[model samples]
Target: MPSSTYLTPRLADLSVSERPQERLESQGPQSLSDSELLAMILRSGSKGRNVLSVASEILQESGSLNGLLKWSDAEFRAIKGIGKVKALQLITIVEICRRVRERSPVTAPILDSPDLVFDFMRQDTQNLEIEKFWTLCLNRKNRLIKKVEVTSGTASNSLVHPREVFREAIRQGASAVICAHNHPSGDPSPSAADIKVTRQLRESAKIVGIDLLDHLVVGNPEHDPLSRGYYSFQESGLL
Candidate 1:
């Protein structure tokens, strides 16, 4: 068996020019490779392996840095040298990244573009361990007013309440709302339950004088709704 020492050298051991943090400080984050960026989070490795090696292993196992967010704590700990502390650290860091991405400014209005809608939703909804139903309140011009979480549940159901959905929209004085949810399975294809929820929300919005702009099912990049040809109620003339 290959000893863990076979792993890559430590970030600190590298020359100043080659270190991820040094490179990031001097050249910016975009200049670092995915493993290098992750190395900054892992910080240190097991007794035998260096941080870069552990990060590389994690990225290789996960297929990408973002993909690591999909892993549960237990799953992450099951890796060769990671333990509970490392697992929690990884989870916390990923969560912070998700939150930061979600809160980032939306300079442009979230128009009818499904891609833009997906971009906004993916910041929080993507890589979720369970299903989450959320709404984006929009003004008449389709500019984003606020994003609110309506419900959360297991893989099959988000158990969203129509009243809760509209309450925020009304409070925000939104003229319209776009409902979005995610599948942990990475498939954005709308399920029958998803369709039922959309139809319900649309009818409720109508009764409450709020327009249901669209219902978007968000998933991973590989299973992107727009790319995979998923149906939207507005586009199908069902609304």
Candidate 2:
């Protein structure tokens, strides 16, 4: 019994005050460390390890709690104690977090500046392996009415049409629209095709009686030549 006890000092073996569930109830969720919160979710451990140690290993593999949001089911399952069911559950948890973050609030964000637009779209665009174009429909005050993905394409190119862009804006009854797309290569500089599309969109906006506020190319700062993480057509006098 002593050797077995040493081998598995599970949550049940821990003193009441030391247990994650007890601490959570007494001190609140915020009081728990990232690993402890994860331990609470995992509930148990395998072989000789305890749940807290297993949770710590998971965080170490992911680098941070935010990094874990981008992990896939396969990635979660690669860990020693994380079987198929646990992997699926973890993926579901991540998906729920993503949806909650994407839920619109009572006060919609005003995306008047390039910085604001970048921040609004960053989470949606992060870790994407291909190109995706988005249209942000806005009211007269530049507050977001809705966001729509107009197109998704390969690593190098995403087809964007003025029709698709303006159609969503018109459907939303938007007075203005901001267009954004990501470069998987991490360079935010607009390609020749991007410029040509923007010119076409500028003309279409006039015909449709909708303002084209800007066209933004999003990329990571480390890969962007300008290191700005994004390039704005309006700021460059292109729109």
lDDT (CA) per prediction: 0.80, 0.91
TM-score of each: 0.53, 0.58
Off by over 4 Å in 1: 1-108, 224-226, 229-231
Q: Give one digit per residue, the lDDT tens place, for model 1 in 187-229.
A: 7777888778778988898799999988887777566545652
Q: Please write out the lDDT profile of model 2 over residues 9-118, one tens digit for every residue.
A: 76777799889899899999998999999998888777777888889899999999888989999998888788899989999999998888887377889999999999
Model 2 steric clash pairs: none
lDDT against true structure, model 2: 0.91
**In lDDT terms, which candidate is top?**
2
Q: Considering every candidate listed, which one attains the maximal TM-score? A: 2
Q: Candidate 1: deviation at residue 144, Å?
A: 0.4
